[model samples]
Target: MPDVLQQRAGVSVLVCDVAGPPVATTETALDLIGNASFGGAEVVALPAGRLDPSFFTLGTRFAGEVMQKFVNYRLRLVVVGDISAHLAASGALRALVAESNRHDHVWFVPDLAALDARLAASR
Candidate 1:
């Protein structure tokens, strides 16, 4: 399946396929942003599985770089999936997730339903 444009809580979202190529670099992240922009989506919903393992390792700074790209483009990035294992391994990552969730630019949610709830609350 390909990435899809969806509307959740009256917000346009580009929902990426789980089987899509891993977003391992900033350039890859830009591609996603471009797709979302082309689709007129305000948000990009990327499954956590699609993210490279380095994204979960805070020291690698992969997460920061990719997320910064989204922020620079003024697009919201919603990482959807269970990241318990990653959270368990790094306190810094855990804190970053916590901090990111507190804002509107980036979020890490366990499922689409959670993302919907968050979108609903934001509006």
Candidate 2:
């Protein structure tokens, strides 16, 4: 279920169901953010099923653009679910995680619990 929601607390989060290689459409990414705003979510969390190598490579393309917009606009993003397998097979991904960590706008946590904690701390 890839969707976006605007929380009652005035926060918007886009829940992503994107897996596999990143799609070649910017509109698709924008849709996720729009829908989340429509819902009532303040932060976008990558569900457990959507964590894949492609998501990293493809998703990271927008790291400084669209993804950064989400964070800069005060939206939180969580991208860790069952990434152990993702981390094991891809050195590029490992590096991506390490690089992504150098910044505070994005978070590469271990799971939803950690994601929640990070988001809470952000608040």
Candidate 3:
């Protein structure tokens, strides 16, 4: 089951526990999104290993599509885990992560603790 909590006064974040295989495509992204929506969650947290390698690559449209969907649905997405290698590999992706972190919509953090702090700060 997913955990939903109010981080701040009224900021609710949904921590998703993805079971079984990894999230490799748009379909998987949608599944998570749908679940979040159904549960009335404002933010969704996807662990590091749940995502595929392509999501870390800027050239691939997987990340874009997934991000767009989250935005379109008015859902905040927090990708929790270490992405040092991916950031080191591409400057574009690094920039994207930095920019996303500046807002309350989407964020990429090194760990769940960082994500918790981020959500708290947003409110």
Q: Where does candidate 2 have its weakest 10-residue lDDT segment?
A: 2-11
Best by lDDT: 1
RMSD of each: 0.5, 4.5, 2.2
Candidates arranged by lDDT, highest first: 1, 3, 2
Residue pairs of candidate 3 with colliding backbone atoms? none
lDDT of 2 by residue, 1-123 (tens): 434343423335555655533433455446555665566666677664543334655445643455665665565556756677767877876887787766666667776566656655656
User: Candidate 3 — which residues are off by over 4 angstroms?
Assistant: 1-10, 18-20
On TM-score, the stronger of 2 and 3 is 3
Ranking by TM-score: 1, 3, 2
Q: What's the lDDT for residue 53 in model 1?
A: 98
Model 2: what TM-score?
Answer: 0.60
Query: What tens digits encode model 1's per-residue C-alpha lDDT throughout 1-123?
Result: 999999999999999999998999999999899989998999999999999999999889999999999999999999999999999999999999999999999999999999999999999
lDDT of 3 by residue, 58-121 (tens): 7988889999989999998889888898889999999999999888778998877777777667
